[model samples]
Target: MKKGTRTSRLTVFVVTVVAIFAMIGIFAQDVAKNTTLGLDLQGGFEIVYQISPLQEGKDLPAMSAVAESVSKRINVLGVSEPQILIEGNDRIRVQLAGVKDQEEARRVISSTANLTFRDVNDNLLSDASIIKEGGASLGYENGAPVVSLKIADQAKFAEITQKVSEMGTGNNIMIVWLDYEDGDSYVKEAAVAQAGGEAKYISAAQVKSAISGDCVISGGFTESEARELAELINSGSLPVKMTEIYSNVVSADYGIGAFNKTATAGIVGVALVMVFMLVVYRFAGVIADVMLALYIFAVFAIYGGMGGVFTLPGIAALVLGVGMTVDANIITFERIKDELYAGRSVQNAVKEGQSTSFATIFDAQFTTLLAALIMYIFGTGAVKGFATMLMVTVFCTMVLNVYVSRFLVNQIVKSGALDNKKTWFGVKQSNIPDVAKRQEQFYFGPFKKVDFVGKAKYFITTSLIILAAAVVMICVNGFGGKGALNLGIDFSSGTKITVTSNETLNTNEVRSDFEALGYKPSRVQASGDKVVYVTLNQALEQDQLTSIKETLTAKYGIEPNDNVVTPVVGRELVKNAIALSLLAWVAMLIYITIRFKWDYAVSCIVALVHDVAIVLAIFAIFRMEINIELISVILAIIGYSINNSIVVFDRVRESVVESRKPKLTNADYKQIVNDSLDKTLVRSVFSSITTLLPIIALLLMGSGAIVTFNFAMFIGLIAGTFSSIFIAPQMWYTIRTHVKPKEKKKKKVKKEKLDELTIPGIND
Candidate 1:
């Protein structure tokens, strides 16, 4: 290589790396700040409304209309990116992230907002029907805020005023009610309205003369109150009733604290991964680390640009993404090491390694990306956020981890920096074999000759024993006997509140407080020095919930994270999660079948199920709460875990094709499986470690719901690695060498018997 050419390539590599870092550094904060956060990450609330028909026997109200109503009402609250989604045929889920006033949001979203004009006797003269759609406006009346209305029917307003005026004395009063339900009268609600109870009636006046065309309702209201009244009126009334079937509210304090802690943990985890690469691969490791950084930034940038809701699970995904991202670089580096061990030149080895690793890396990443898309499509709330982050990570891995890392390393290889010392790629000088007499049976990896297939029986037995023990434990009060999986409010339909105080809290006191309000908690546990979690068996009504939250805040100096799930919503959530899990398995099975074969696909599915089952079993044994996030976590583990089996199977396929003979024996197939695993085992371990480092960080240092996410991820990673190594490939081997031959023998017997039947002389 010419000195000038090497200098140019090196310069290009440096500039590219610097530019990426510089750009990210300059704009990262702004993007992060501007990026939309989910209710779990930012302090806000999500409410799922179940709508019923306005009148009995009528068809259910249009979900779209209710969503529209919610959208208009929340829009008036000036909340950004309020997710108002119409779910199924009769539900609307409104997510208001970064919203401060939860009570107001709930009221506005569900209120009927029926404007009516009536007398003291409650005789309705006019209602919202006579008011123009956009007629309600906020204005000032004698320095007090008032709502002005443009009456569509002049004679109707004039008639109401004249009737009220002729009624005489204390009986001649006109009343304006926002939501006038039957049996509500001026006399009955007048004292309540004066004492500042519910703001059902906006304003009332004793009419001395008839007026028409335009009128103003003055209630000595503050500007905010007047503005809310105008917005409610202008948003138009919806006849349908919106019942809050589910809700998740996180206080701003908890959200911000979680964000900071999780982010710090992620940083520590990623830093550890980068350091691991640097120590293992040296200069090549540096390149991998650089690319990993770039991949991280690219994922965040894409997610932020796409207007994704960054959530607690999203943070966990990002951390796991770092670990997953490292696998891309690890594969190539290990492959390069293999080429070096085969006595290839530095440049040639770099080329061969990248070429060999690309297909495997692409296959692994594509499978994960496919699963994430399914997750995104099927998931809601935090799970959706996690899916988005995972997709971004896999996508960025495809680009940066594969292409960019390869390019950067190629730049170094082409620059001739490591030309004289090929060991810089991590292979030892004495390890490179002589090319002139290369052994035909040479195993090309760093793993020892362990005879993985020879121990298949032991591995399978161990797996069965552990699984059986888990089942037995569950039947004996682990999960199946006592309470299965410790299902969170998301599945059980109740209220779970996490109250953070300025000082230490007594669990007994927390229980007493709830008991004081007539809500006996199912459980009260202290989560931290200043935080206590209270679980109620019943989901509270909206008003009752507001009162409880207000009381808690007043006493604790923090608004608790309140989660409420109704039976209807909980059932639906559980149903959807199960269906999505099955769908993911089916999709993965079909995909693997197309990519590999039926045996490998089936084995992969078995491994996936095993990984999921292990996580559930462990969580059940430990009595950890399983929330909605588990759905995404399990899917992510399956999607990511199968890549291990896929990688090994990919190697196995190559070995099978290369070792094909006229008559191959079972021992030959066994040797093939063993040899393939040996070749890929080193990479598998490295990949898993690199991926798990971040999750371990999250598990140890993270806070709130994220710890649960990371804990599950951490266990899933181990189970996935174990299954890929022990169970999946062994199952495939058996199906191939044992099962297929029996079917062949059976077919042969049937064919011979048919031949004997067809030729009667042969049978005699």
Candidate 2:
């Protein structure tokens, strides 16, 4: 170690990190001023649109063309960041986050997308009647004028078609129509149609059939009927028929309750973690606790600086990460205890402890980093947000908890500030044999050196089978294309609403009655018996609103609070999410390759893919609906799996440096891996357990869509733990087996390369 240059290196590292913070802080402030606000914090308009299903025997492409057209139309409304998506087979949801005016949003969405009618000559014609009522002319139909109508149904079509057919020999049999007065049901009557016209106009029978799909027109219609017919012909049906299956408007009070509970949970978690670490390691633990506090500050700074949204899942990641913050300190402290037990002076023990723990810490952190990268790439929305926050926080945690904490403790010990060994966390000097100095070789009893090379074929075959099965299952389920995993309304099309009132009410009664009215209720779960979650199969249509209200009002004895937010999935959004996920993994793999050996990087990435496949497999097998929520858990798993691999590699690197065995085959070196796994097993399990707690809470107590996301993480964490310990170490051993031992003359040349493979003292 270059003693003189060490201080300069440390100074540079600190300065660089500080500079990053300063720049981020400046950008964060700018973002707060410029960035768009999400719908949650601000009151926004919730737009629910329906997807029109394909008519039987029709040549149309069903929902596809409608979806594309609706997206284009919505884009014209200038609703930036509006989520417009197709849901299931028949629905399109358009959610405009941060839209304040419900009426304004509705006006934009409720208008007919477009209605173009081609004449026999392929010429265009304009209708003045429908255009006056905010109706736009689509085109011409059958050598006549065709206009887009905003009428509720086809009555306008019938009147117009009848009048158009009765042009010349018009009789005085005037058909009276009505327009309802404000807040009144009765309509003021007026003549809309007259019976009798030339035979050139469409017949009654023909008009009826066409009006079934689009509105029809007839000759000799009065001003009112013609205008009404124009509106009907112009207004197009929704791509999918929908009902407000679920809506819950979070009242100010409920939001406050949720916020308080979440905040309390976070504060308690941090306090408990800090207290536990300080109590266990005494003086050294104090240093770790100080760093833990610093880590918290750094996490906030990074998130705020990055303009990272603090989503619920993101909160969970931070809480779990907090519990695991002291992991590096624990490893280091344990090493120091062992060194002190071996009759080393406090200063030397501190030095050795720091040196020994570096590799273990790096390995553990690196594995977590790998997982974070993978999740960030593959996940959408909140999942990516969580991954982004987790990766940044993990890096910050490592720096503070490992380096800063260690420095403070080590320097204090080295300065003779803590002269008495007994005072240093009550650590009394103890006599123990020095394993490093011993001439005798230590061995775990009865463990055979199994020849992995002999079993390579079987190993390869088994791995291929597992990998193949995963791919086959995904493909068969259409999980790879179309709709593999059940996508929630957020990613697909549907309406989700939550409503809460101070008065207690029957959630089921409200839900069932709504369902009975053809509201397409997907789920009705109660949060704390007072809050009811209602999910609809599709977005609610304007016509269904009155019926939905009547049903809820009848059942609950109260008008249902409709805080509706409809999110639609677009093809482009889906494509982007997939591309991002793939890109994340590719980018991470490239980074790993540059940092380590290409082989190691590839192995790590494959292991990541393996983890992701298993998670998706579980989802597909169980019919778990995919959504943005699941993305968060997947990201967390990536970090966990990679952390495990790094730990094993760290130990393997250490063994390469220290082992003097003449017959040190890859199998003989297996103990190094076992030792690393053994050392990490406790911390890994503990971290997983802590991480599971909030997810369990969320599963039992949180939102419906979020549960699936938590489950993904729950499954991923367990799988990641298993693969990291059992699979990753085995991979390293297998890879090393392929590296042939050099000839006696080439040994010197090989040593340098081997040294390159080994990161010295990293796994101390």
Candidate 3:
């Protein structure tokens, strides 16, 4: 290369680094300011409603209209930018952030707002027919509180009033009813006129003339009641009845604390990953570190741009993205190292390594993206948020870590500054073999001599034993009336009470207190310094809920926040979780088969199942809560395991394609498999370690809400690494040997013969 060209490339590299960091700095601040926080990370409440037909034999239309009605009602509570989701065929979920009056908000949302006009004979004249949409207001009628309504059809209202006026002298009256109930006559309604009844009789005015356009109804209503009635009327009536089946309320203090702790953990986790990369890969590592910074910026910028709500789990995903970025870089760098060890020129190594690793990277990222897509489709609330962030993370890692990092590293190589100094690429001069004698074998640190294939039976046997024990545990739990596993409120119908006291509370003491009250809680734990979370198997009634709250408040000097989930929602969540897992497995299998071959695809699926089973086995043995977060962890494990398997399989394919011999014996094939495993073993271990670091940090220091989630991921990462190394490749080898080995050999020979014949006339 010319000196001037070298200097130009170096200058461009310097400029690019500066520009990337500057852009990141600017976007980071923007994300912090503009991004919305979810209820779990902000003081708020969320309610899930099961919409039923108001009458028999009436089916609802997937709750879209009901969601809109509820959204309007929530807006009346002064909540800005509320989240309203229509879930499935008969449910709507509403989340309101920074709502101060929980009771008032609940009342405003569940009101029927069925306005009706009746005659003295209790005959229906009009029902929600005379009032215009969004035209009801609280006003004064002759110095008394009244609800004023704007008539949608003035002519029709006039006819009704005229008919009432024509009645006999004793019956010439019009009546107004708000949410009129059955079995309540005008006599009982008249007795409860001031405070209102189930059939709120607003007014019974004598009609002397035809009234049209706008009218006011007054019947001793207070200012607050009149205002509420007007708001409900303006919001429109819900077409179906919304029964609250699940709800969660978080206090501002808890939300702020969780956010701070999780953010701190993320910072620490990301910093450690950056330093590890810089120390391990040297110059290439520096490039990776810069790209990682940009990766973080991209995730936040895209998330904020899409108006995504940030939650605690979402933050964990961002932290996890750092680990994923490290994995991508390690895959590329390891391939480059292999090329270097094969005595390739620095420039040639960089080019070929990137080209070869691209397939593995794409396959890995796509499988993870598949899982995230399924989660987004089947998940709810914070789980959905986590899925969205995971998708964003995968996208940014591919763009920044794979392509951008490759481009930058190639520029440095082209500069020719580190031509002789292979140490900068983390390779020793003594390690590079002579070009003439180069072979497919390469050392993976101290693991070069490890016979991973020979010990496959032991690994497989061990995994089966553990899996069997897990099955037995679940079966025993089921038969013993303890349930299949320790199901959280998210997976079972239950109430979760989160109580914060003035000081740190003991978990056993809290459990004993609940037990003394004849309430055998399913689980109890003390989170952080002052919060105790308790889960009960049965849903409490309104009075029972109030009693529990009051008792806790009196004992602990603070009111407890409560969350309730019905069995209906829990059953639906479990069903969706199972469906999502199956879909992810099938999608990954199909993807791998298309990218490589069916043999590799089946083997990858087996390895994935192994990893997930191990994680579940540990969870069962420990009786950990099986919730939606565990489902996310399981999907993550699938992605991670497949990622490692693809790396090993890619190497195996490369080995067989580059072999010199026309036919391979059984021993030769075993050597090929073992060599491939040895080459990728270091990369697998290093990547898993880097990934597990952040998860460990989260487990120890992050929010207690997600500790179980992080712990599951931590175990799954180890198991995935093991399966990818020991099980997946061996399974592929066994399957390939048993299915049509002679056919492949014949095809190879026929192709060689055709190559040798090569049309004599063309050559001559």
Candidate 4:
């Protein structure tokens, strides 16, 4: 079990990887058993009911009482984990996690069982069921719209009818109750006469006086009934009469086609990166790629083990992560190449490569991690998912690039693999010659100092104005009706439709027709030119769905090839997204502060906040619609931005640690920070360029509202890079001088001048 032994270590590592994969398989089964399938993955039904607000001038307590009463009715259905909660105003959102049959789910949700009792003259009497199902119009009986009630089986309808007849005066008093199973709303009403006499059973009207005029129907309520009722009431009340806002039966054909294309894209991206590595670095790159493959195995094992849902955005994150994983190897392998080219012996080059690239790897990884942490902390829904994926990949890549790669190279060197006349990996042995024994002099490039105080007022003032306006706009819009930012159906409540025609059709034609029908669709795409997923806002009722489908059939000559679809957003899901985002940020702040110091933490937070605020401001300024995709884009940009700051900070920290012999002045340290920024500029610009391409493609070629999200990301990417270089470091200086001004001391002249040199390429 010696930690450094080669054979033993490799065996353990291999075994560990195998065990994790094994566990993942087992966990997959478990997840299949308990994991709730999202509407997209498994054909299911989701019905959202908006609980109506209280009547104008109603007391808060009364509203609470009503909500509670509604909740009780939903619980009676016995559906486990029914998501029910109050939304903005009087709206409540109810989510039934899984229901296979869409039609059946809809029937249960929209049927309002407003059981009531009425006398011959049709005088209304107390019944909560009637209130719950108030929208229904009872068919005419004896020239009056008379509501009928389904007498409970236990009540003995015949016996009750007889008893009420004997008790007397019934000129047609009818009892009404809603039957939840079939959309069969009005059952026949039984006549009722007297109150005191026990008639075995009486019309709901005759029994209205008892049970304190408020009754809870305990028996005959099915599991689905409770669930539906809960959703109806939890969501308060329907807005606009609960019309089908949107619906689409996902064509299995389109789903499968998209899956194939996505899978192909992923494979291609990975293959190209792998090929690049092999051609560029030869033996070391081969080793890196092999380890890179292993890294993929390990990362996926983690994803599966964590029950990470494979989604479109998730796929994007994975692919992006795959590309980024190569970044470290590129940096390391390039360093090794540089070492060999600079005339270092194989052993010396190997050793130097590890030591020299340590800072770069550490700096890059740490910065990226910092950004991921922020996104995971502050992002909502899909943003969180994307951030989590990025974070996991970052961690795994660090191991593969630094530790695993280092060990492999070390083993090859120790075994005299590169001692041949020609380098073991086809490199020339004569090319390896010792240059410097000391590790102190390895430099990425020349360094320069930069400061912001000279233009501090302009930057600060403009930033504040932008930030303030964003705040004001957000307050006015209130996230497009919610306190939080508006999310697309990807994270917000919504339905999705994937359609495939018998023949090929233009995607724009399909999208135009859908838009004309008022579906506000986004992410519309054609696969094989015949199938498409036209994402739409969540529809709450069957009518809304029918309306959408009718339009598609009438206009596009395409029927939903599968079943009709509706999706409901649960309160818990939204809560979790918000909570997780907040938690991630707080956790990151604490961790960073503890590892570094509170001062760094404060500066990082300021910059991060500034970055986020500016992003929000831009969104507001453009009047761009922000959705879950947009949120994810913002988070991604934030991650990139924070990495920029972290690189500068890491350099400052290293300089501080190295200068312990004779402490450098603040000015001298600033110069060190400036140099670090300059040194890493190429990497930053390159990485940013690489990252921006896909997003830019998405913006240019992607459908509908996805462009809004992409645009937000585009702005954020530029802003994040800027803030990291200008905002964070400058803020750090400002805070240090103002908050701890007394700590300032006179600096050495030369050191001070060196520190004051301007950072290259940064705008004044």
Candidate 5:
């Protein structure tokens, strides 16, 4: 390289590093401050409601109208940045974060403010029909608190008042009721001069003449009650019934503690990964570390830019992304090292390594991206947040980790800094073979003699046995009255209470207490010394939940975290989860077919299914609680497993193309497959290990909330690695070798036929 050229390359490397860090510094605080936090990370309650039509056989109310009503009601609670999303066709999810009065908030949201006015005979005169929107207010009438209403239609109100005035002297009374149900009636207010029994209503008033515009309903109500009534009146009535199907309330202290613990674990885990990379590959590792940092910053910047709400699972995704991003770097650096081992110069090695690694990197990252899309489409709440972060990380890994890392490494190599020295790039001088002596059979590292193809039958048989056992166990469980799997409250309609005490509480004692209260808990387990988890098969009402909390607080000296889900919502979630998984499978198959061959695609998808099945089987055998988080983990495993398969398949494709064979015999196919596996075995193992490290850290040291999630991923990582190395390639080889190739025809018959027909006129 020329002196000026080398200097410019060195300058480019330095500038890129400085620019990335500087941009991170500029946006870090703003991103942190602007990014939203989900209810789990922040303090608040989330409720999923199933909206039903009030009248039988009537069409369900418009979802938009229901959402608007809910939004208005939430606004009255004074919740800042409340989220109300319409889920599915007839469900709405309301999240109120950082609200002080959770119980009151729930009551207000579920209340059906159906205001109605009836005559002395209990005949309905008018309802919210004549009331103007946002026209209700609290006012005083004769030193008593009253709710004032403005009529939207003067003629309607006048007609109602005229009917009331025409009644007999003692019967000319108009009765007002809020949310009047069967067997409910208007009662007279003790403070007002009225003649009627006491009931839950605003007031009963006598009309002397027809009223036109404004009306006042005064009752013996406190200032707070009067204000609430006015607010409800202003918000109007919900058109449909809102059944609380799912709800969760997390305390602020718990959230803050979890955040701190996970954040610390993440920092430690990432630091360890960086140090390990640097130790393994010197200068190349340094470049990778820089790219990893940039990848994280970019993910955060994009997350904040998109107004994504950060959650606990999201944080896990970010930490995992840091570890997974290094895989791309590892793959590229390993390829470059292989080139150096083949006796290529540093410049040529860098160029050829990047070119060769691009397809593998693209295929792996694209499969993961497909999985994320499926997750986003089917996931909800924290699961959805996790999906979002995963997608962003995959995107950044492709762009920042792959291309940018390649650029930085090439700059360093081209600057003549790594010239003549293979050690800096993690290749030893003694290991480099003669350029002319390089052979296809040469392995990159250790385990070159391992026969992956010969052991295919053993691996396949073992996997099938395990799969068959899992199926039997699931069937037995399904018929034995428990379930096919231990479904959590998120899947089964139920209430889950997590209690923390100042002192260690016995699981038996907690179970006994719940049973004594006429509730048989399906499961009771202790988490550490202070926490106890209780699951009931039936959803709890608000009053029941309050009672349980009070009881637990009085006995255990700690308030409990509570969750509820209805059967309707649970079934919907399960249905969507299955659909999402199938969709992802089909999408990945299409992608693999387009990028590689159909045989390879089929084998990869089969491996993916094998991984998913094994993970689920493990869950069933262990009876782990299968929840929404587990669903996310399963999809992640599919993405992760296909990534490994693609890497291996990419290598195989390259080897096949490089062979320059007109027709591949079975022996040739076996050699190619085995050679590709051997060459890439080290990379695959290293990548899996690097990815598994952080997840293992999370499972061992992170918060209890994500322990199940981490465990699922951990099992999945192992299963994915196994399938990719053993099953996927073997399946592809078996399918490829079964096909017969067409033979070429010979041309010698034409000469003999011409000799025999020489006497014809055409011969002359």
Candidate 6:
């Protein structure tokens, strides 16, 4: 390379790095500000509705229509980017992230009816059952839009109105549910409002007269609103009854805690990883950190572009994403070091290392991508948010690691500044051998040789013991024993209320408060002494709900947030979680089988199961509340565990290809596994360290729910790294040993005898 050319290339590299960071600094805040924050990050509430036909077998409208209806309902709330998802066939999950007052939001969401007249206590007096078909229409009354109804039974209407009038002046109005169904009550609607925006309530002011032919009801409705109500009644378009099966409300103070703590944790965690890279890999580590900045910027930018919600789990994903992206760089740089150890020139090592390791990085990233896809498909609420962020992170990491990172590294290498430096690439001086004198098939790796394959039995036995221990703990604590896992309201049928007060709350005081209300809380936990979480054994009735709300509001001056999960929704969540896990497992298994072989796939699955079992065992022992977040954690571990297995198997396959082996013997397989482990052992360790750092930050700094999640993730990282080294490859070796290859068949030769012809026309 000419000196001038080297100078020019180095200049361009320096200029590019500065420009990338400059752009990142300028646009990062803009992107973050644009990105939406989830209810878990900002104050809001989330509800999952289980919809059914107002009348059984009546053929409810399509989920799309219901969603559209729900959208129309939320549009009135003035919430920006509210998330409404239609889940499965009969469920809709609505998330109002920035809803200031959920009272109106709730009221607008679940108020559905079929023109029923009820009292304040929601006792039904009359319904549209007596109204003649097409009796309802839009009309103007006193310069306001009103709904006109022509009654079939004027006598019945007069009697109902007279009864409503008798309730006295202040409470004389009948609670009306226009175009609503009979299954729900206004009291329940007022408290629950499980689905809102459809039901219209009219305060008749006073039923001054009994003689009424066309009853015109007005409550300051818009013409469009009155017209839709009248049209719905005339068309008899019955609104689908929505049952609030599950709801999670995060208080503003609660969300602020998560936001502040997690933001601090993520920043500190990712910074430590960057510093670790620089310290260990020297100058190359700086390059990795530079690219990592770009990677983070890209994730936020892409997610912001796609209108992805930012959540605590999403921040966790980004922090973990930094580790995984760093893993790619470690793979590439380590490959170059290995090549340099084998006496290749720095430029040759750079090109060869990238060329060989590209596929492995893709394989690792692809498997995790598969899990993210499945999670996005089958997950709800926080899991879905995590999956969304994960998918974006996956995309950014893949593109940056494959294209940008490599381009930057190659440019520097071609500039010839790092020509003969060993330590510059994180390789020791003694690692490279004398080219003329040394004559080994492969150079000894950086680490001393360890026969990981020979210890397969011990590793498997250890994992089995862990699994057995987990099972025992679960059984002893579960069902008939101690009630098994600490099931959250998400996986159990109950209500969880969060109350915030200006003074620090005593758990015993909170317990007594609930007890005074004719209920004893199953559990009472306090956060920062000001916020308290109370779990009840069952969902409260409307009156009970009202009493609790009034009581808490009077005492605390802030309404208590409640989460109610029905048994049916709980069972469905468990079922869907199991199905989602199995589906992800099967999908990854199929991919591995197509990529490698069945034995490798089996080993990978076993390792994944082992990792999950360990996590479950730890959680059970620790009594962590098992919730929907567990499903997300398990699926993520599956993706991550399989990725580790794939990387190991990739290296083994690479070694065999280099050997040009037609078939592998037991000894050959053992040698391959051990050699591959020896080569990747350092990379795996470094990868684990980088990955573990962010999660360690999570466990140290995150709040309750996230602490639990990150602890599980931390366990998974350790298990994944350990299994990739000791268990997975060892399992592969053992499987290969037991399953012998079929011997090739030998062919027999045939002899030919020559015959002579005497003449052209005669034969002998």
lDDT of 1: 0.81
Supply candidate 1's per-residue lDDT for 94: 84
Higher-TM-score candidate of 1 and 6? 1
TM-score of each: 0.91, 0.58, 0.90, 0.58, 0.90, 0.83
TM-score pick, better of 1 and 4: 1
Q: Which digits, one per residue and each the tens of the lDDT, describe model 5 over residues 1-764?
A: 68899999999999989998998899889877877777776678899888888777899878998999989998888787788888779888888777767888987898888999987666788889788888889999988898889889999899889889999797788988887766654433332344455566668788989998798888788999889889988898986777887899876656666677777777777887888788888888899889878887788789988877778889888887876799888888888888877666677778888888888888888888888988887778776778899999998998898778888888888888777677888777677764434332133667677778998889888888888888888899999998988999888889998877778889999999998878999999787777788999998998998888888778876567788888887898899889889999999999998887788889998998999989888888788899888888888888877888888898887777666566778888888888888878877887887778788777767878888888888888888999988999998888878853232332233211111211224531
Cα RMSD, model 3: 5.6
> Which 10-residue span in candidate 1 carries the lowest summed lDDT?
747-756
Instruction: Estimate the lDDT of model 3.
Output: 0.82
Clashing residue pairs in candidate 3 are none
For model 6, the local distance difference test gives: 0.79
* lDDT scores in order: 0.81, 0.54, 0.82, 0.53, 0.82, 0.79
Tens digits of per-residue lDDT, candidate 6, 1-764, equal 78899998899889889999899888878987897888887789998888888778798799998888787677656688988998888889999987876766775677553577777666777877768887878899878999888889888888888887888776676777565444655655554433654343553346655746757777678997787666556544337888877777777776877798898888888999999999889878988998888998898888889988888778888888888899989988888888877777678878889998888899899899999999898787777888888888778888887788887887888998887575798877776754445433256685447778777678778877877777777888775656778888777788988888878788888899999989989889876667788999797654576688789889987767778888887887888888988998899889998887788888898888888888888887777777777888898898876777888899976766565456667888888898898888888989989999999998887765576679889999999988898888877777778875342332233332111212323421
Q: Residue-wise lDDT of candidate 4 within 1-764, one digit each (tens)?
A: 12356465566545655564576566655544543332333333333344432244543444354445545544444444444444444444444433334555444444443433433433443344333332322233444333322323323444333443444454433443332122222222221123333222222444322121222323233444443443443333311122232233333333444444555555665666667567656876677667666666666667657756554466566666665676676656554654555555566667866786677567556656765776666553345567778888888988876787677667656544463322534345444443333222233343343344355467778888887887777677784674344444544555656565667878788788777776677456564466566655544355666677677666556545322223443344455545544554565577567666666667777777777778778877555544456556555654556666665676555555555345445676456656656655554554455445555554544432234555676677677666766677777666665565332233333331111222335411
Q: Pick the candidate with the highest TM-score.
A: 1
Lowest summed-lDDT stretch of 10 residues in model 6?
751-760
| Candidate 3 global TM-score | 0.90
RMSD each, Å: 9.1, 12.4, 5.6, 11.7, 9.1, 11.1
Residue-level lDDT tens digits of model 2 in 264-366: 6566656666666566668876776666666666776667666565545666677667645666777677667655554455667788878988876776676
* lDDT (10s digit) by residue, model 3, range 1-764: 68999999999889899999888776677777878888777788899888887777987755667877888888778788799988878778888877877788888898777778888778899988677877789999788899888898999999999999999786888888766666656766666754555445767888988897789887678998888888888888776777899998887777877788888888888888889888889998899889888988888889988988888788888887788878899999998898777667677788878988888888888888998888898778777888899999999989888888988997789998776567787777677754444343244445667777798889889988988988999999999999888889888888999988879898988888788777998888777778888999997765677777778778988667788888888898888888888998999988888777788889999999899989989989778888778888887787666889988998887777767687776677788889898888888988987888888888888888788889999989989999998899889889767773332222232221111211334521
Which parts of model 4 are misplaced by more than 4 Å? 1-104, 110-176, 179-262, 275-288, 291-308, 323-545, 559-591, 597-599, 602-624, 660-667, 682-715, 722-764
Q: Clashing residue pairs, candidate 5?
A: none
